[model samples]
Target: MRIGITYTILRREELEIKERAGDFGEVFMLHEDDMVFPSNLDLDVVIIRNVGHFKALYLARLFESEGIPVVNPFTVMLEAGDKLLATLRLKDRVPVPDWRAGVSEKASEKAVEELGYPVVLKPVFGSWGRLLAKVNDRDALEAVLEHRKWLRNPLYGIHYVQKFVEKPGRDIRSYVIGGEFVTAIYRYSEHWITNTARGGKAEPCYDEEVRELSLRAWEAFGEGALAIDIFEGSEGLLVNEVNPNMEFKNAARVTGVDIAKKLVEYALEVAKA
Candidate 1:
C-alpha cells in the first residue's frame, strides 16, 4: 500500500502518525509548504491532516480525481470545515445548539436578538476557539461585529450566532474513528471557552450518551476520523462542532489510545477497500 499525508508544518501528532504509517506501508509526507499539486501521485490512499480547509479540499479533490481515496473525503471537509454548514446538516440528524447565520452586520444583530444575549459569536471557519466571542449583551455583540468588520475578512464578516448552552465550565470532546466511537474527554476550564488550545484541561469520560451522539454526528459527516465537540445541554448532548482535521495528541495521552496507530491502520484499510 502507498500512503500519503498532506501537511503544512509537521506537528507532534503528524510526526507520530507518519512513524506509525511505516509499519503498514511506504509512507509519503506531502508537504503543503509549496501548496503545489504533485505532478505525479503514486499513492493508493491519503490521510489529509494539518492543512487548512481550503488547502485540504484542494488536495482531496486532486487526489480523488486520480482515483486515490482520501480519508474524510472532500464532502466531509466541505461540511465540517464550516460551522454553519455543519450545523445545518446535523440539526435534523442529531441534537444541536440553537444557531443562526448571517452575512451582514444588521443580519447578525437580528440573529443575536432572536437567539438572545449570551450567544456565542463564532467565525464560520475556525478552530481551537480562536475568534470566538461569548456576547452577553448587545453592546458586546456590536463591538465584536465592528472589530470583525475592521478585519475585513469575508468569512469573519459572516457571523455565526449560537445560543450558548450552559455547562459546568467545560465541554466534551469525543473521538470517533472509522464510524466507531473511540473515546472522550471532559475539557475543564474556568473560562467559558474550554478548548485544550486555550489551556483547558483534559480528563477521561465514558458517557454512553456522548458516544451515541458522536457516532450519529460522524455519520452525519459521512464517517471518517472526527472529533465531535459537544456540550451537555439541559436537554441532552448538543454537538457544537464537527472537526474533519482533528488534532489528537492530548486526546491520545489522556485516553491511553495509540491514536496515530489507529489512524494509520484506518488509512491502510481504506487503501485495501
Candidate 2:
C-alpha cells in the first residue's frame, strides 16, 4: 500500500511518522508548497498533518474525489476546523462551553452581557489558542471588538464568544484514536489558556472522568483521531474544544505512546476496509 503524509511545516510528529511508517507500507511526504492537482492520484491512503492550511484541505478533497482514502476525512475537517460549527454540532451531545456567535460589535457585547464578564473571544477558524481574548468588562469587550472591526479579514467580524469557566489553572488534553481513548496529559499554566503551544508544561494524567468525556466528545464528531481539551469546572469535566489536526509531540513525551504509529495503523485499517 502506498501511504502519503501531507505537511506544510515539518514538525517532530511528522518526522516521527515518516520514520516509523516504513514498517507499515511505502511512505511519501507530500509538501504543501509543491502540491498540485496530479494527473494520476496514486496513494492508497493519505494522513493530513497540515492543520491550518487551506491547500491541504484542497488536496485532501481532490484525493477523495479520486476514491483515495484521506485520514480524518475532509468532511470531519470542515466540521472540526471551525469553532462555531463544532460547537453547534456538539451541542446537547456533549458538555461544550456555553457560546454565542455574532457579526457585529453590538451583538458580541450583548452576548457578553448574557454570558457575564470575562468572556473568551475567539476567531471562527484558528487553532493553538491564537487570537483568543478574554474580555473582563464591557469596556474591554468594546475595545477588543473595535480593534477587530478594522481588520481586513472578514473572519474577525464574526465573533465567537464563550463563557469563561473558572478552573485551577490547568486543563486536560486527552488523545482519542479511532473512537478509543489513547492517553492524556495535564497542561499547567499560570494563565487561563493552557495550550502547550503557549509554553504550558505537560504532565501525564489518569482521570476516569477525563477518559469518559474524551471518548464521548470523539463520538460526537463521529470517527477520526481527536484531541479533546477538557476544563475542570465546578461540576465536572467540561468539553472545552475538539482539535482535528491535533498536535501530540508533548503528549507522546509525557505518556510514552507512539501516537503516530497508532494513527498509521488506523489509516491502513480504514484503507483495507
Candidate 3:
C-alpha cells in the first residue's frame, strides 16, 4: 500500500519524518504548492503532520471524501484542534485548568471575573507560544488587545483565557494509542510556555497518574493515537490539551516508546477496513 505523510515546509524535520515513513510503505513528501494527487492511483492512508496547515487540512478533507483513511480522522483533529473545544470536552472526564472565551472586550472582563485574576489569554487556534500573553488586570488585558490590533493581528478581536497555574515551568506529556499507554515525559522550562518548540527540555516520568490521565483522554477521543498535555499544580494534576497531530520525536526519545511502528500498524488496520 502507498501512503502520504506531510509536515510544514517551515519545520526542518519534514525530511526526517519521510525517512521513517519509508519503513511502512512507499512514502512521498509534499509541499503545499506541489500537493495534488492523481485520483487514478489508489492510496491506502495519509498521515498528516500538522492539520493546522491549510495544505495538510485540505488533504485530509480530500482523503475523507474519497474514502481513504486519515490517521486520527480529519473529524477528530478538526474538533480537537480548537483549544477551547478540547478543554470543554474534558470537563466531565478530568479536572481541566480554568478557561474562558474572550470573544470581546467585555467578554474578556467577564471571563476574568469567572476565572479570576492573573489569567492567560491565548488564541483559540494556536500552537507553541505564538500570540500568547498573561493578563493580570483589566488595563493589561486591554493593552494586549490594542497591541495586537495595532500590529494587524486578526485574532486580536476575541480569544480564549485560562487561569494561570502557578508552577516553576514544568508539565507532563503522555502518549496513548487505541486507549493504551505508550509512554510519557516531564517537560521543563524557565518560561511560561513549556513547548519543546519553545526550548523546553524533556525528562523521564513514569507516574501511574500520568498513565491514568492519558488513558482517560484517549477514551474521551474514542481511542486514537493522541498526546495528552497535563499540568501539575497545587490542586494536583489537571489536563491541559489533547493534540492528535502532536509531535512525537521527543516523547519517543524520553519514554522509549516506538510510536512510529505503533501508529503505522493502527493506520493500516483501520485503512484495510
- Candidate 1, backbone clash total: 0
Runs off by more than 4 Å, candidate 3: 10-17, 50-52, 150-156
Question: How would you encode candidate 3's per-residue C-alpha lDDT over 1-273 as one tens digit per residue?
Answer: 687765565343345556666877897665556656544436787777754634555677877788778777776776566677777778789888888886676777788889988988877666786877888887897788777668665556667888998875789988887667888889999988898878899987889988998888777777467888889978789888887776777877776777776777676776677
| Model 2 ranges with Cα > 4 A deviation | none
Write down the TM-score for model 3. Answer: 0.89
- TM-score of model number 2: 0.96
TM-score of each: 0.96, 0.96, 0.89
Candidate 1: deviation at residue 54, Å?
2.2
Kindly report which residue pairs in candidate 3 clash with one another.
none
Error of 1 at 120 (Å): 0.8
Local distance difference test, each candidate? 0.87, 0.85, 0.75
Tell how far residue 126 is off in model 2, in angstroms: 1.2
Report the C-alpha lDDT of model 2 over 1-273, residue by residue, as the tens digit.
Answer: 899898888899999888777888899898877667753758889899885646556766888888888877887777777788788878777888888888887888888888998799998887788879988998888888888877778889888999988889899999988887999999999988899999999999998888888888888888878888889889877888788887999999999998988888888877887
Stretches of candidate 1 off by over 4 Å are none
User: For residues 114-231, what per-residue lDDT tens digits would candidate 1 score against the true structure?
Assistant: 9987899999887888888899997898899889989978889778899988998889999888987888999999998999989999999888888889999988876578889999
